[model samples]
Target: MRRFNLKLYLIFILVLLVRISNAHQETIRVGFIESPPLIYNKDEKLVGALVDYLNDILPNFNIKFVKTPLSRVPDLLDKDVIQIFPMYFYSAERADKVHYIPTSFHALNPCLCALKENKIPSTIRDPKSFEQKTIVHLRGTLKNRDFLNFKNTNYLELPTQDYYEKSLKMLKLKRAEYAYFADFQQVKRFLNNKKHSNIHCENSHYPKDEMFFVTNKNFYLKKNLELKISKTSFKTYLKKHLSRVNWQVD
Candidate 1:
């Protein structure tokens, strides 16, 4: 009877241990920003290219998403409020704080989006061309810094307090004259549903850059997550997304 009681006690302890272990297992926190086609809010749900890709690949992994404005994403990473940002480009400053996944998910081709009626130069071969234009860009985003490279251009940055949709609206309403920069495909996708034929992307633009997954230095599951991402085929997902978009447009 003592042996039987001992066995039951041991089983109870094992069960408690298992529960504790389960409780302590970290749930990966992936940071999301409002970049249309890549990530955006729809009907209060996170939905976009990156979201769909993550849903397909991370079903078996434990994950929680934190969605915020594009500008705040960098701050959240700096504060370690989030563990992972699904897509990021490398820079010496940013590289110091985060570990970049070895694989690149996509190439980002950013361009100037302006109203066709404005007759904005389709090609931007000469930096001198945009001398006095009231260029508008999303505040605190990659574009803000990118535009600074054009020393000859004077650009006005939109308030970060506002949303990206507002920037598009401003362009549509001709509130800003030119130089609203964004990913060409993303801008095209955004314009598809809108009633604007005047909006078009400039042929000449910033050089293409690759985007990769990046995680904070202290994230617990960093090693395992990076391993899985390395094994995954990013092009497969990109192809699928493109096909879907083409079919929908057709």
Candidate 2:
């Protein structure tokens, strides 16, 4: 009688565990930002290229999401608070620690912005241009390697509290010689607006950079799911998202 009860108790525990797992079904959350035309914020809601992309593809993983500032992502992610990010450039150190699901490197066209009258050479042309220009950018991101060699690049890094809006203000007040950003319509909006005639994009950004996601590669649940989505499925998922975001791709 006692033996029979023990067997039944074990079965009960097994069933209970399974039930708990299914009930929780925690989703692998990813972090993204509000970069208009890429990731935009509206009404305390996030919507844009990255958001749309994830909305379509994330379902495949049975994961949930949380939109957050790019800087905050690392802290949450280091402890596996969240396991994903919409788009990130792969790095050797990150690759060793995080799993980069195969995806397009060149995800979008790039653009550079600066004051119109500030003839500092469109390209930065070379790193030396930084010495003559003040560069403002979203913190916690790698600046373009093209300008890395230049040590004299005067720079102003802002927190998310006042990123783009502050940048616009700086440019308008001629406080910054240049601000680096990549977006089609938003850059156009800034350039076309009468208030921003002094600031404009370079001829255009060249050697367009690529963007993709980074998964901790350490979380077992997310790892298995990410792997289950084959390369073909991943690419197809990405394409569908691109279409949804109205990004032009050949």
Candidate 3:
């Protein structure tokens, strides 16, 4: 009778342990926009440096990646439709809507590109120098406030759905004298392609912007996510990952 009672007790403890472990693991829905080489769909699979990094670091959580439009991210996050969003620049307007991890993981360098054949002067080193020039960029990605320093520059904001192709078309058609990209590495990828050989970017004078992972205001695991990332050597991991993809990380 003593042996039987001991066996039953052990089974109960094991079951309780299993239940506790299961209770701690959660399914976190992560929202992502189409930013190639960082986060984009390929062969029907969502794959990129950020995707791989998150999957590797967050083993305790089941991450479900959801493709979201760039413009709808803030609303989706507010509605609790997605628990987390990666690779977003910090802005006062955005901070009100989401909780930003205290640490920034990457610095995105701005790039101003123009067609080489157009022979646009490379003297445009500052916002003041962009006077009377028409620049094109993704709509939601940039705002009039961003170029407030420019006196009389014209900005043609394209839709975010297929911004990469549209921005390139705008430049090639001479509709815009310059194309502005938030990340130099992303623009470099397009410039490397033979089809876009005419597009060339001059050394940028704009300051680099830091990018961070943001979570919904009420996300239960926000602190846990921040703690995990804080403990990891994310900068080293990001440098290696970017190098592998032929992107320069500074």
Best by lDDT: 3
Stretches of candidate 2 exceeding 4 Å from the true structure: 1-25, 60-64, 67-75, 193-195, 203-205, 220-250
**Overall lDDT per candidate, in order of appearance:** 0.66, 0.59, 0.74
How high is each candidate's TM-score?
A: 0.72, 0.69, 0.77
Candidate 3 TM-score, true structure as reference: 0.77
Q: Give the Cα-based TM-score of candidate 1 against the true structure.
A: 0.72
Residue 134 of model 3 has an lDDT of 92
lDDT of 3 by residue, 38-104 (tens): 7666666766678777977787777898877667778989897888888777788888888999887
RMSD (Cα, Å) of model 1:
6.6
**lDDT at 217, model 2:** 57
Q: What is the lDDT of residue 53 in candidate 1?
A: 76
Residue-level lDDT of model 2, residues 1-250, one tens digit each, is: 9999999999999999988876776566767665554555555555554555555555444455566666565566777767887566656655665667675433544555666676646564577656766777667554545664477767777765546567667877888877656544445654454356666676353555567666665656454435443332334433443333322111
Evaluation by lDDT, superior candidate among 2 and 3: 3
Clashing pairs for model 1 are none
